[model samples]
Target: MEPLEEIDIFIFDTLTDILFDKVPGYKEVVDMGENSFFSDRSTYLFMNEFAVYLGGQIIADRTSSFVESSFD
Candidate 1:
């Protein structure tokens, strides 16, 4: 298996933080993916959700609310 890149680690850590705060049994869910090579449906769904959330976070982080307000 390939090692996770730096960005992958960042996303995983961010997702872990978010999931640990918001979801029950997140460790089990993550373990399912890690153990199964992500063949499980639950793991797949969680990864998809994490990716979407991370994408949104990245966009939000890069954008300035002040800049947005200037256009109004």
Candidate 2:
């Protein structure tokens, strides 16, 4: 795989790893108002959602969000 492709895989896998493994109830935490790990909930949510966006890139393809945009 190319360096860029490897980077994409690394980012996507890391995001999923942290979201699914490290964080407990990450979806709920992102949505909850009381959660104040950062300056505010919106910041936290935006950061997480943006990471997911970079990792997922759902809008780029219809089949799946995690699909890489790189050409074979």
Against the true structure, whose TM-score is highest? Answer: 1
Task: Report each candidate's C-alpha RMSD, comma-separated, in the order given.
Answer: 11.1, 14.4
Report lDDT per candidate.
0.49, 0.47
Candidate 1 overall lDDT versus native:
0.49
Which stretches of candidate 2 lie above 4 Å from their native place?
Answer: 22-72
State each candidate's clash count.
0, 0
TM-score of every candidate: 0.33, 0.31
Best by lDDT: 1
Q: lDDT tens digits, residues 1-72, model 1?
A: 346555555665675566555543444545656334333324445577555544554577635442232223
**Residue 25 in model 2: shift from native, Å?**
6.5
> What's the residue-level lDDT of 43 in candidate 2?
39
